[model samples]
Target: MGSELEMGKRPPENAGNTTQVQNTPPNTHILGSVSTQTVDLFNPPSNACCFCWCCCCSCSCLTVRSAKDKRILMTVSEKQEDVDTNKMPQLTLEEVHAWGESFERLIKSAQGRVHFRQFLKTEFSEENLMFWLNCEDLKKETNKTMVEQTVKQIYEDYVSVLSPKEVSLDSRVREVINRNMLEPSSCTFDEAQQQIYTLMQRDSYPRYMNSSMYADLIQSFEQLNES
Candidate 1:
């Protein structure tokens, strides 16, 4: 009973205030006067690392998977062993004495080869003996593919000028290797092997014979035998 009022839809309480329509995307909600973003932890962004919760950079988990792919892509035969050693069996007095008789005898003995290699290392000529040993292993290969791979590895290690362990070889032997490279067989390195063998026999073998390394081994063996 104040004055007669117009009978119409009542004005919204907020009519006096500006009604703002928030342009929020889907899955968003307004709570009170604050807007908070919610993330679907189940579906993270592309750059996010699943391995580490806080890490966003390219991570080791992804790199390890890539390494696994590379390993799988390589043939089992072509892959080198991750760990290897040149260790030989324990030496014996008989083996030590035989080393003095002839270079061939020394080369045939595992223990002798180990000691001789140590001697050659001091002379910076170990590659000659290493080349000879690799050829021995190469000659044992029956598979054509294995022969080819082994040949290439030996060439890279001992025949190539770029190699730190490149062995000495005459022009004739080198030319022969270059010529036979196209169709390699187990005996592809025979000439190179023989050249290195002869080189070791003539030069390094005598020096190794006179070295205290050989003398000490012989003395230790004799002493051990006496004990």
Candidate 2:
């Protein structure tokens, strides 16, 4: 009775079969171990080798997971690029002729903004144009969370008195901005934008119209039209 109990406790008489199974690939052993841990047999763990055909047979979960990770990374990269693009103003020749006609016409179009910004750069007042453009961009944002973040960034970069790029705003406007900052909104910079716009129209616009840069650009346009 003792011998029978010992034999029953021992493995199968096909000792060679047990040895053969033990000689199986390491990944198979890992798969079996993972299976015992309540892991979904259909979905292998991320650490598993995706190329191991025998161990990962019919299991494309790792491959799918890898692709999904790559897609998410790509999406984040694209969003970062968009943010950088937004921070810098865009220019186009969509209405180049209109811009060349008058300073008012030039300031109204995207191309005009680019040229005007170049002139402002020389005059050391480029912050005015940058601030105005940022305000315009801020107005188009509908996401409440994004609007709040953008408002803060604009205030820090162009509205704050300590900022190197700070626009020339009066004490009243500055006080209003400071009060509004406690509860920032998309329209927080409206008065500031209006003031800057008026400053450019009255001050910078006339100077730009009379500047050699404007005259040269107009001459080039006429030459192009004639050709």
Candidate 3:
């Protein structure tokens, strides 16, 4: 078959005999013959559309793995990129709860709920799906490291701006934080609300309210209260 799509110099006759180069689509230059057996430009395999595939392959290097694993890696990597760029998905109350349950199973940490919740601020879309996957990776790669890192970052970045004043709180807020610290995953809505109300006294409630530890505390309290 004639190489109608050929746009560059021909591949050397021996290109495939020794070198198995998987070139990309745009500006692809084959150093050997374009045979039927010659592999198509290594477009990453994806469930996503052509735009996503092209975007992924163009931006990222395919991993070194079995062809199947390579495809999986490329798909996952590109999916993550797309999710990061796209809006997050939306869910009804039931769907959100289901999603949370899935997260609880997969993430297995208080911080995971925090990460997933943070992601929910954006619209529910392919992008958020990818982000959820990435957060899972982050959870896996760093374990509790992310929490300490966040704590350190907050300490470094925000601490400098504020006077060395301790974060004053009403006893209720202190009690909530203390309870969560002891239980690690137990804080309920009423208890948490009391904490928040107490924090309002010091204007420190909102600052720590969105924290995963706080969320975990609330969640733990809820779970325990439910139990």
Residue by residue across 1-227, what tens digits does model 1's lDDT show? 12111111222332222212334455442211122321111111111122332222455553333344334324332332121222434445666788889999989976567567666656656667777877887788897756765665566556766566667777788889877776778888888888778777877778678776666555644543464
* Candidate with maximal TM-score: 1
Clashing pairs in 2: none
What candidate 2 gets wrong by more than 4 Å, as runs, is 1-97, 100-104
List residue ranges in candidate 3 displaced over 4 A: 1-85, 90-142, 154-194, 197-227
Candidate 2, overall lDDT? Answer: 0.54
Residue pairs in clash, model 1? none
lDDT of each: 0.57, 0.54, 0.30
Better of 1 and 3 by lDDT: 1
lDDT of 3 by residue, 53-133 (tens): 211334333332245444434433343342221122321223323433433332343333333333322212122223334
The CA lDDT at 52 in model 2 is: 29
In candidate 3, residue 43 scores what lDDT? 19
Best by lDDT: 1
- TM-score, each model? 0.61, 0.56, 0.18
